[model samples]
Target: MRALALYGAATTLGSLVLTALTAAPAGGAAAPAASAFPSFQGAPEAHGTELAAGRALAAGVKFGKCPASEELPAPIQCGTVKVPLDYAAPHGRQIELTVSRLKASGKDPKTKKPVARQGALLYNPGGPGASSMYFPLVSGMPEWKKIASAYDLVGYSPRGVARSAPLSCMDPKDFTAAPTQSPIHPSDSYKKERIARAKTYAQGCARKAGAALRHYHSLNNVRDLDVLRAALGERKLNFMGASYGTYFGAVYATLFPSHVRRMVFDSAVNPDPGQIWYRNNLDQSAAFESRWEDFRTWVAKHHKTYGLGDTAEAVQHSYAKVRAELSHKPAGGKVGPGQLQGAYLQAGYYDDVWAMRATALSQYLKGNPKPLIEQAAPRPEAAKDEENGNAVYTAVECNDAPWPTDFETWDRDNSRLAERAPFETWDNAWMNLPCAYWSAPRQQPVDVRAARGALPPTLILAAERDAATPYKGAQELQKRLPGAALVTEKDAGTHGIGGGANACVNRHMEAYLLTGKTPVRRAACAPHQEPNPVSLDRHALPKRIPAAV
Candidate 1:
């Protein structure tokens, strides 16, 4: 599993991941006094014998040297780090985080022995629930040769993610049985059903996860990350976080500014303290609508090849007709409006899938449904695995802040939004519905402001048309973190903008990692290429499209 650019969207990983809540309140709840969570009291870095004990405990865990495998581009070691389940009680019960590393590719040629490596570079791909243990495999690819050779590329499955103590909201059967939150209509019946299902999912997580659910928020994860820094013997942390990972990095930078070395937050989440999980999703809906128009325009330009239409409006009409037909009769008995949307949403994320998806839609319009059916095909065990991703996503987001408890509030807001941004409005609302009934007590969102010169210079990257984490977030992050530099991928819709296809952005990233200098002024990088129409092979739709990089 390459870095896959984990983010807020569960399906951002394509069919490999599950659906995450689309929207929820950004309001914070009162923090409980005398909790196990870290308080960021006193100086920036922690001291005393308690941290020493946590580090000593972490050091005792075992890791084996890695061997080459099909799943990875290079050999790497896999290990586990143990941290207290509740950071307030460091001596209490503990959980493990699975970590992986591709030791720096440094060798002394004369002696043909491994050379001493620079400090570790920890990376998070951002699902809050996404498995990051294998990210080093992707991050260490040829594109990152310079950085990979200089530092130990480290990754981990955060607590309650894959290979760790994972969270699950429901049994596999019940999980699969749950309907998607796609808006079938603006009817009260649909709203009621959606709320009822959200309740069922929330209650299931409480019944299954019990006390462990309360510890799955972001603050504890940040605490565990600090302990890892100590265990790895690094006085400072060097981190690269994308999407939701940016939020993690932001909190870490705020609480332990003195302990940060060099950090990069690409497609940063807004750390406005007032814009936590909910407002962010609404922003995403608007962004997606804008990007979707771009996709529609691209398809129209290739109408002679796709046979959809000669204009964007015509293309939309043709697509609507197919969607209406799907609503009446699902393709292969599975590709309903929800499944059709799941297949098409990738177009909003990246231009790479536009041609293929358009071809599928064209074929469906021409009285063939096989392409649509294949697009919605189920992955083996995606049901069970998706539950795990969704469960953890909900726990982290719902516990991070207080959500609006009234059903009327949710219904009114989503109803108003759906009129303009119908694509993902309701779908996102239901995705986040579990928060309304979340059992865990909430803590206030961290106000991420660092004193001037408190931390080293940092770099933030954003794509102008990114739908998930929009470009405004990058600007906000730059404004909040004094001396921070911002990089924009002009007109690009891709969520994760650096180190995949953009050499210019990569150069900036490498410079910041190898040397501590960040640009003094904002910068922009051009998109590599606009999507082109695929060959007009109507019968050959791809089995699957990889998630946007």
Candidate 2:
């Protein structure tokens, strides 16, 4: 996915009983040594010392009332949890993680009286880089009332993301100076340019982030999460994570099976360590291509309104024309062919944004570029945060397992895939190119297998046509966690399935969260109503497009 295109849903979600849940270039630096934390086996007791140490660290947690924010829908408490910079050297250095919580309402809606509160329901929005601080506020929404009244909604910006000692790897200008990854069908020169740019991006991170990059992997973030759980005083954790967050939850479960009270993994990530960052992205290319067809078909179905085309192929031809035109002259002097692809990629993630993105495309095609330009405009204040997120994303992903050190391997594999998977093949690759020169040392991926009976029942949500985290990953994850059951949206394209408009999905999740019941076999949910085309007028488009991983 393109850097800008990788944004997520705009809606907030809450924790529930069965409830569901849920990079840059530069120079060559040798891959470092193994992580201080050894590879985890199925034994949760193996990490007892670390878990205890994490609890001890929690004793020092300090919380203060959160200052009110217009952006936040509900009041939340904000605090910091300090953890060792390197768990192996507990006393050497420490970093603070920003944590937030919306206390359970405790008042039963029917009784309008206090009820005993359940433990915290911690959340991660799967960015490896998305700020989770806003998650608690989601509990205030009416849809989340059941969960909001039952458990504290907890959110924390994982280490190196948002306000948690952010690890920014590039200057704001350099970060957005070009597409974070290269476009497909590149000429040989363009290919060389991309490789060089990847190197430059990696070197920039090494220079900017310094040694802290070493400690930014998911293993560490998972450890930090345990600390947060300890600090929150929860004997076991209940979690909801989407996209990459699903992977995080899986790893957490693998490491601390006994500590998993409840978990809902939406749009689950593949746990195959061998694939690492590369193969999975290749999978995304095909998945997104199929989703693009879905978008095209939607556009074609509304040919009378859009006037783009009467057929999916013709609609694609029109889109290609827009891309070509923008390549020559960027709309409003900003959004180019690449940026256009990035913007429209959102269409593949969710049907909610299909109309908005299509409207922008139609407007651009009709010689009014304002919508497209505005869509691509940068937020300078957010640039640093984006950089930090990207940095941490790379830190965790690249360091999670072995990535090819040779650029040729990247070029050869991507070059071959680009021919067949034209939409995002190259874009996905360049997004992960920094791994070729990542400065952090690599570690063995956690042996995620449980002994079939080791883990608590986990509810897994999968959208059959999800572009980012493909459905197959969910299937694999379900197999890996014997107690876990999978809920699939029949033909939904959205990345995050739960808490959306699907009543079927919501009911199944509620059943699991409230009663700890998962399907004895795979269960499928009907897709939500397909979005109807809105007025083509720019003002009629959605104001808050759903974000995706």
Candidate 3:
């Protein structure tokens, strides 16, 4: 996906490609001791030997059973970690999160004169809903290689997302979470009913989730990490969180500050704790709409390439006509207004992607079914198919704080805002409506104001253009945290400062993780200074899949 800007807020990908990598974590007691910096204790990077060894290890394992080592992604090595639904009361009930990992490659168990072996580095590709376990051992994010050289890469299904205690509402239909029926245009009464419906949705989740719902909060996931840390016997944690994961990373640091070793939070999340998640989503909605206009304008200017329109207004009208049409009778066979809208929502996440999908829509405007048909089909499954991260996201997000019981507030707030942020008003509402009736009692989001304690010195990353996690949020976090340094990217059109190809960001992050060096003085990273993107040779655009097929 072309990043909308150098910095972006993490949102759900339309359908990110998932490919296989190192086998799932295999058993064999974790190597007992941590290694010194620059010490290569693992096998060197031998694509052939390590690939062979990894396959051999994978071939022998039974599925659904995770070994103690959180460092391989073989089908046999991963199973589940049963954890209490709620962290406040850990002894009561339990839910399971499927976890996976890539063992340090290049390690020769025999000579022990390791080729490369760094500490464990856990990663998350943000989505309050995206799964981390599915991130290719080598994702588009470049830092994976720096950390991957010696350390184990850990990934897991968070709670209430795709796999871990998956939050299934209305079968697959609800996955779109848009209006089931075409929504009536907003009116005072329409707004009122919308509020009522939202309340009902929240209540329904509460009823369905029962006691287990309480366990799904950011703190609990942190607790889960504590458990995993103990289970893996890692003395401290190293983490790389993008988008929603950034917020998750922050929560973890706040709750268990001492346990942190090194972390990179990219495309940052606003962790103010007071702002509602839906409200945050609203900000993203507004940003996306603005970007969409830019896209329309760009397309209009390049009518020959796109054939959408020769003027911005014409292109906007073209897109609006589709919106209006979908608002009434959806196009194609099965996609409804909500699905179309949700797909539009999916379309706007990255700048690079919007144009391609927009072009696809442009082709659709000509009455070709290919674009619309592609939009209606299910996305390709991840090569190493693991559960997506919906459960983990909801588990932690729902528990992090409480929502207003008054549905009127929700309706009043969203309806009024939707008028201005038409692109994502109700869509964002439904994306979060489940919280209204969340089954568990809402735990107050942690009031985390970081104080420089003995926790490891950390690096904070922010992209000035990031809308999902706004640069201000990252700035605020950097200001509050102790022993932390901040890095910013200016005039860039992608999210996540340290990820992707920017060498400026990569070099600093590399030095930090590889040598325990935090950016002592804050610096700026721009696209020109960025490293070449991963797979620059394979310039496939971001893939946008149907909301639900």
> Which one wins on lDDT?
2
Every candidate's lDDT: 0.71, 0.72, 0.55
Q: Write the per-residue lDDT of candidate 3 for residues 95-157, one digit (tens) a residue.
A: 666766666665444454555565567776666555556443453234555455567766777
Give the alpha carbon lDDT tens digit for every residue of 440-510 in model 2: 78877776666777788889998899888888899988888888888899988887877777888888876
TM-score, every prediction:
0.86, 0.88, 0.75
217, model 2: CA deviation in Å? 0.7
Q: Count the backbone clashes (under 3 Å) in each candidate.
A: 5, 26, 62
The true-versus-predicted C-alpha distance at residue 395 of model 2, in Å, is: 1.5
> 237, model 3: CA deviation in Å?
0.4
Q: Flag regions of model 3 displaced more than 4 Å.
A: 1-76, 87-92, 107-116, 139-143, 173-185, 188-193, 276-278, 310-312, 376-396, 437-439, 528-549
Prediction 1 global C-alpha lDDT: 0.71
Q: Which pairs of residues have clashing backbones in candidate 1?
A: 21-431, 21-432, 22-428, 24-278, 36-88
Tell me how many residue pairs clash in candidate 1.
5
Model 3 misses residue 230 by how many Å?
1.7
| TM-score of candidate 2 to 2 decimals | 0.88
